[model samples]
Target: MLGRRATILSFDLDYPALYYPADSGSLAGQRRFVRATRVRLFALFAAALGGAWSWRAGSFDLFGLLGFVAFAIALGAATYLQATDPARSWYEARTASESIKTLTWRYIVGGDPFPLSLPETAAEKLLRARLAAVIDPDKLPAPSPSAPTKQITDRMRSVRASSFEDRRAAYRDGRIEDQRGWYARKAVANERLKQTFTWVAIALELAGFVGAAFKAFGQVDVDLLGVFSAAAAGLAAWTQARSYADNQRAYSRNAYELGLIADELDGVSKADWPRFVDEAENAISTEHTQWRAAKGLGAPRQRNAASAPES
Candidate 1:
């Protein structure tokens, strides 16, 4: 029993870690890439401003050199850190992580293909194979073998082998309740991002108008008006690049869907419990898979992201 528990726990940790790599590993690569990309973008804009300032001040050499360096840095980031790709890594990693999560949910709930009629060893092998096939290496390669281990607590194993009431309660708290909260929070976040970026873009446009007015009255150089225009354009470009509005709409829709799912599961009958679990888990996986496809990250595969394992 001891050995069996360890084996199950190890697989739980290992499979999720295969592509996405849970815990701090998830944040590290993404954080590094985001910061690096931002640095490069800021430098590019700063370079444009510097060049304008240099021309106005007749200090050509210094600003020209700065602009060249900024351009080079942006190119380097695009090449090495994949700075040009918007949310590709995020979507890929998140898809893999969520797929593993769905697999675990189905396994614990003992719904559909889980709790095989086959022997323990064969069942475990099938589970791992199905999971491995789900991870798409085309978007993001697998993590290093030396990737940090995920600590599998006693709860995952116990829950997997638990009684009906225990499993149902765990599903109630961990799946339905938790997912509702997550969807709500993410919806709010996306809305906030959209609203904030929209306001910032409007402010930039106002600034540009003010600058253009001043230049028309000959109160400032025409070149200064160009600076404000560039800033306004940059704000609009950034808003589109981030897809803040689209994400806001998507999150809002998903949150409403999850709310309905949660409500339907309230006091579910045992006879109908398995089907409920099936629908709930499928809803979660389908949401992520749809998000993946919207972002164009996992659409090229012969198998849809949800069908890869969770379907």
Candidate 2:
């Protein structure tokens, strides 16, 4: 019975209207920020190389022109970064996306502050209010004209109206297990990325050291040291910006925590289910809180205290 119902019900179809737009905005902003940062780094590296080459060439017009163009590219990238502030957009949009996603899961699973005992009308109203409270209109992009209008879908209502066993099964399988798998995958990916970047940085440093040694022996007419040094510095800056190591640690911790929470789900009674769900949600929220903190977004909002429905 639970398997049949789960097959029919879909979280994607029932997600709130605002979530898609916020998610899109977050992704676009992230891409823009990454592209701009890379462009700036590359431009600076080119400028350093150009300057070094010009010096070695005794102020040749061609090398001077290359340096001028490189500086111009760097300046343009910096100006674009300042004007767009893609990082801020990415963070705020991500906040809205995650908040809506968490609330949607809570509502569908009949979790705390959105229990199945509440009247349907009251529950919908509370969900809407909570959604509004979490989203800042000015920070997020406008919803597309084709975006879904219904915030609470019929599938969501059906899931909420399911028996305790079905609801528990659905939440456990759909939410907890899914999230745990995602976190585990992300942790592995981030760890690989961290190691890759670290090795690349080390290689660049070694190259710079070799260039310096060669320069000291007067074996090369052109100074490769300055160029390699600039490349190393750029790699370091990019690695810091990516925060691969931090994300790897955070994702691994969250994956383990979610595994533990999933283990506790089977023993929860109907009466204790709501509290258990809240606890699980809190664990998930902790990961997001760490994410926001790493991005310098201050503390997570007190969602239960600030947006809980009135008795």
Question: Evaluated with lDDT, which candidate comes out highest?
Answer: 2
TM-score of 1: 0.77
TM-score for every candidate vs. truth? 0.77, 0.90
Per-residue CA lDDT of model 2 for 1-311, tens digit only, reads: 10112232343335777777778788889999999999999999988887777443555667667778999999999999999999989988888888887898888887887877788778888888888777777777775566676777787888888888888888887888888988999999999988998898889889888988988999876668888889989988888888889888988999999999999999999888777888899899888888889899987463444454544
| Cα misplacement distance, residue 287 of candidate 1 (Å) | 2.7
* Lowest lDDT block of 10, candidate 1: 1-10
Give the per-residue lDDT digits (tens) of candidate 1, residues 1-311: 11122122112222234434532233554666566666666766766665665543365567667778877886776676654353556655566667667776766666555643335445445556656655665555445666533323345456766777777777767776677677777778878988887788788778778877887898876456566666666566566656677777776777788788767765777667667777888777766777767766654243332332333
Worst 10 residues of 2 by lDDT: 1-10
Q: Which candidate is the best by TM-score?
A: 2
TM-score (C-alpha) between model 2 and the true structure: 0.90
Clash counts per candidate, in order, are 0, 0
> Candidates' lDDT values, in order?
0.61, 0.82
